[model samples]
Target chain A: MNYFDAQTWIGGWPFSFQPAHRAATLARALRGEGIGRALVSPLDAVFAPEPTPANRALLRSCRTLRNLLPVPVINPALANWREQLAVVARDRSVRAIRILPNYHNYALTSSEVEAFVSEIQGRSLRLVISMRLIDERHEYFAMRLTGVPTGQLDRFLERHPDMPVLASGLYRTDLLSLLPRHPNLLADLSFAEWFDIVDQLVRRLGARQLAFASHTPFLITAAALAKLGQVGIGATDLTSIAHRNLERFLKT
Target chain B: MKEDGRGRAEAAELIAEAARFGIEHLVALGDVLVYGRRPAAEQVREINDDTAWLVQTFPGKVSGFCYLNPVLGEREVWREVERCLGWGARGIKLEIANNARDRCMQPVMAAAQAHGLVVLQHAWSMTQIRQRSYHTDPEDAALLAGRHPEVRIVMAHLTGCGIRGILAAKPHPNLFVDTSGAAPEAGILERAVDELGPERILYGSDVPVRDFRVAIARVTGSSLDAETRRRILFENARRLLKLP
Candidate 1:
């Protein structure tokens, strides 16, 4: 199956040593797990004050790797976010704009996010809201951040019903609460887990509503793949979840 | 008799499910949370009986662990352990009944030691949680291992235990960490291998709460070598359970 990882990062993460920090190495790691393409973002942007430099660096690094599509991080809380968006939008390979509401310390319900959503709609770029980067319980003692609240995400999804958004790093319970209400919401399987998880998600939300995500560098890539590969599901549904779902979501 | 047939069918399905993922033997740690923490003696028996049923029904394919509430004190603990032994329980499973360091654990550890049974303690890092008194932290489990050096102990949840938990289990040869609990983080299994050798780490699914395939892949898909993965996934578990 041609797998497309909807959540992956390349760059430095201060908390732990990531062997796949470079774009070439990360791509090779993802490919080893049979992931043909991935929506790549920069880990540097996650902690940076301004995401523009990291965004540009990501676009430059992933330029040669066709399978690694750059998904630039946009911190709308920053006053110069419009320029950041404009710069990353100019890159032809860019398909999605990722926002770290918790890491960037902004509420999804804030006026800044309202305007950010409007700008994303105008640009025809897909929006990926990262609910969390790592499990908060095991986070570094000095720098702990909770996941973006599901209630905030519900309101955000409710406000932008037409804008199809992919919410990454959601737990299984988070997906259960969010997916039913917002049909426009698409989720990745990076964090969602349970017995027969893929089949359960497909049964609950349908295959069209879910996408494959590795949450690479933070999680084992092949572990994420095994969630899909080892499940008892139809080939068509598997293909839809493996790549087709994200492909369709990205196109819109 | 009808219920027995239904249970056998269910057990068959479980074995088949494990077989689908190449899992040969299952260590049935009974639904540890069905009665909530600090289950009554009868509740503990009911849980172990359910496990004993699986072990009796499937013999070689299934190994039973007698779940105990250490707070139940010496008499009840001994009675239940002795009863479970007759039904073929190979290990003792302790959940969040009380902290592992509590005086109540004396009888439970003694029971395990007398019968030559391994002890699987439900342990996680108490760094974030406030309930260290009742909950068994990795540090507490390590203390338990230290107190009873003869007993073989498995500290459950490698991810929840984290780096601190790995370090806590380092000095004690008897304390093994299972690759279960929470989500599969990238480097934890590799880190565990580096800190403690392959034999000290065991593969665990925490099944139903965690996906079996995902848990297995956490070890298989890691940066660890083929031989180390084999030891963690199968050989270590086989040796630990004393499976022929």
Candidate 2:
């Protein structure tokens, strides 16, 4: 099955073993997992003070890899947030900007985000908020970062109610709670899990609100995809989840 | 009897769902401890009876594992095990009634060794959670395996145990880990194969609670070779369960 994965990362992690680190390696790995196209970001951007360098590096690495679309990370908390946006704008492959609010140590309610969202909207780029990279409970002892609270996300949506935001790494509960209040919000299935997750989600929220995300390298690609299978949902819904929704999200 | 009223799928439904991924047989481990850690003997009996009913209902499709709370002491543990075995329970299931390192596990392991039954213990990496007192951390499970060398032990929840759990099982040939519980973390199964070899691993769905697709994909989607993947998914469980 061909998939347009909305959530994925490239570059090395601080831990011991990583499935694929470099852009080419990650692209090949994604292809092996049947991901036809993926929105890729640099892992280094999450830690760096300014994401411009990492974002530039991501653009450079994914230059030849057509399947990998560079989604540069922009830390709005940093003074050089505009520069990061400028760097991504210079790269034609970049279609969206990813924000790590928790890792960057800023609440979604902050004026910084308000200005950042406005700027991103002005540039005609979509916004992807990474709620978290890993489960907080399993986070490295030294770096115990919590996910962006549902309340903050709700409030953030209230401010920019019409903004087409794609949030990654949200739990099932988080997705459900946020779904009703924020109709403009879209989520990826990378970090969510439950018995018959797709069925549950489709029953509650329509297929349009959901997209496929492998959370590759950090999460097993096949494992995330398999959740899509054996879910007892319709063929059209499955197709929508696996690729169409994501394709539409990127296009719009 | 109070149903969850949630319209949970039945065994036939589950089997059909699993069959999509080529899973023909399932090991039903009952509710384990529906009444919490130190369940009354009757509660244990009821849970096992339900498990036996599932085994009977599904016939060739399901295997039963008797749940025991060893904290109820040796007599209770042995009696329940005997009763469940009479109903065709092929193994023993131990939950968080106590840590594997506790003295209570002696009777549990002893009964398993005597009956030639596989002991499936719930375990996770307790480094951050710090619940090793009642919970079986990977280290405590490793200790349990060290103490009972003759008994074959299966530590449940490969993702929860993580790399620490794989390393914990490295020294004991009789000890194995099951790929159950939690979301599939990349590089974990590969590391498990690297550290413990393919034979020491088994595929587990933690079904009804976990989706069969996700659990199976954890092994199928890993970086392990086809043979190693086949071993973990089918061959190892077959050997452990003595299935033809």
Candidate 3:
């Protein structure tokens, strides 16, 4: 089945060794792993105080790669976030924009985040909220950034009940817990794992809520696909999680 | 298997799940030290007895590994090893009873050597966490292997051990690392192959705690050549266990 990676990154990471982060390399590598498309973001956005330069670089790098869709990172906490959003939204190719709440040092419940959600809805773009890029237990010692708490997500969802928000890098338990409360929240399968994860997830959350996400360059792409490939689920559900749900999530 | 301290899975269910994954053989390491890092003699016996029952019931499908708590003293360690071996156990399973580098392990290694059994030590790279006292870091496992060259030591959790864990296991020919623990981090299995060779690594699904599908993917989804992948997924483990 053709897969769409909802979580992927390009550009160098602060960590020691990372796989090929160039868009061209990533596109080829992901294709080899059976992924047809990826929602690409800039790794520089995780550490940078401002996200415009990194987002622009991501757009430039992915210009030629049709399969690699550039999803710009927007730090809503920054003073000129509206300007950054305007600059990013001008490109017709930009169907979605990502936000790093923990790294950007703002509460998800803040007015800035609420406004950003409203603006994305107004502009007809999808929103991808990165709960984490690295595993919390193994994050670089000095960097020490925790994942966005479920309570915060709960609160954020409460404020915007109708907005369709895609949360990347959530643990299986976290996903299941937050899911019951917030029906509008969708998740990528990048970080969720277990014995028969897909089967287990489908039984609890249903197939429509999940999208395939490899978190490539950071996670083994095949490992992510293996979950989809080996799970004991129906073909229709498999197709939904693998690509169709993500396809619908993106604005036309 | 994957026990998250919440619910319990039946043995019949586990067997069926393993069979579904096309797994014919299993290394039955008891829920050793589930009570804590240092379990009482009764707890140790109970855990090992559970493993024994599983092995006996499954017959050809499962091989039991005797759980030993060296900190419980040399006498208890030898007794459990001898008892479980008599029940057809082929190896010793050591959890966080104590550090692999601790003095307590000497007796455990001696028992494994005398019995001609493999030793699977639960290890991860504790560099950042720095709790090397009770937790068996890859370095400590390497140190144990380095000290007892005669004993075959399988360090558990490749991703948990990370690159440093692989590097530590590189020099010790007697040391092996298992592909278990943590989510599948990209490029780790390849780096492990480059540093320690495919034969030195074994595929392990810390099942129940981790998903069998994802665990298999950690090796199969890697960029290694088919032969190397085969070795990791099947051949190496088969040879190590001396199974047909």
Candidate 4:
């Protein structure tokens, strides 16, 4: 199966030893798990005061690696977010721009986010809002970040009903609550887990709303693949979730 | 009879599904949260009876673990432990009824020590929640293991415990950590193996609540060698439960 991971990161995460620290290593690892292409982000960007350098570094690293698509982090809270967005938008391979509301210390409901969304929509670029990269409870003792509030996300989704957004790192409950009301929202299967997760989600929200996400270097890539492969969903639903849905979502 | 039939069918399906993933045995830890954290003695018995039913019905395929609320006093704890032992419970499962460091756990730990039953304690890092009074932190579980060196204890939810939990488990040889709970974060299973060795790490699904395939992949997908994976996935658990 040619899986297109909607969520994955490369670069050192200070808290834990991220195995695939380079794009090539991550690409090789994902390929071993049958993931042909992955939408890549930078782990260093999550903790940086300004994400431009990390985003630049990611684009540089992924330049030669065709299967690794760069998804640069945009911190609208920073003064130079437009410049950051412009730099990444110049790259045709850059299909989506991700924002870390909790890490960047910005409210999803902030005026800056409204403008950022407007700019992203204007440029015809997709938006990927990361709910969290690591599980909040288990983060480093000093770091006290939490997943972006689902309430705020609901409001954001409500505000930008026309802008299609991919919310990564959502728990199963979050997905169930958010996906039903927001037709513009799509979720990655990085953090959403249950016994029969794929089948259950497909039954409730339809397969079109779900996409494959490894959350690699932070989460076990094979675990995500296992969730998708072992479920009893039909070939078409599986195909849609594996790559097709994400493909459509990015194109739109 | 109708409920029993439905339950049997469910159990059979579970076993068959698990078999597809090469799982031969399951440790039935009763719905630990069904009656809330501090379950009454009757509620404890009710949960155990359900687990007992699965054990009795499935025999070798399923092993029963007596779920206990440590706050339920010595008399009730002893009575339930004896009753569960009579029905062939291989271990005692503890949830958030009381902290592992609490005075209430003495009788419960004593019962397991006396009966030669392994204890699986629900432990997570309490740094974020701050509910250590009732919830078992990795430190609390490790302390419990330190207190009773005779009884083997499994600290559940390795991901929740995180790296701090791994270090806390280091000193106590009697303490083992299971690869379960939360998301299967990359490198945690590997870290556990590095710090505690593969023999002390057990593969746990946290199933019905967690996906079986994903849980298995947490170990299988790790960078560990085939031998270490085998130890974590099957051999260690088999040895811990003394399964024939």
Assess each model's interface with DockQ, reporting 2 decimals per model: 0.67, 0.63, 0.63, 0.80
Give the DockQ of candidate 3.
0.63
Alpha-carbon shift of residue A132 in model 2 (angstroms): 1.9
lDDT comparison, 1 vs 2, better candidate: 1
List, residue by residue over B139-217, the lDDT tens digit for candidate 2: 8899999999999999999888888788989999999999986778888888888899889999998876777788888
Residue A223 of model 1, lDDT score:
84
Off by over 4 Å in 3: A14-16, B1-9
lDDT of 3 by residue, A90-194 (tens): 988999999988888998999988888888889999899999887776676676678888789889888888888899988999888988778788899888877
- Give the TM-scores of the predictions, in the order they appear: 0.96, 0.94, 0.94, 0.97
**How does residue A233 of candidate 1 score in lDDT?**
81
Which candidate has the highest DockQ of all? 4
Candidate 4 true-interface contact recovery: 0.82
User: What does chain B score (TM) in every candidate?
Assistant: 0.95, 0.94, 0.95, 0.95
Q: How well does candidate 4 match the true structure, expressed as C-alpha RMSD?
A: 2.3
Q: List the candidate 1 regions with Cα displacement exceeding 4 Å.
A: B1-12
Ranking of predictions according to DockQ: 4, 1, 2, 3
* Reproduced native contacts, each prediction: 0.62, 0.66, 0.65, 0.82
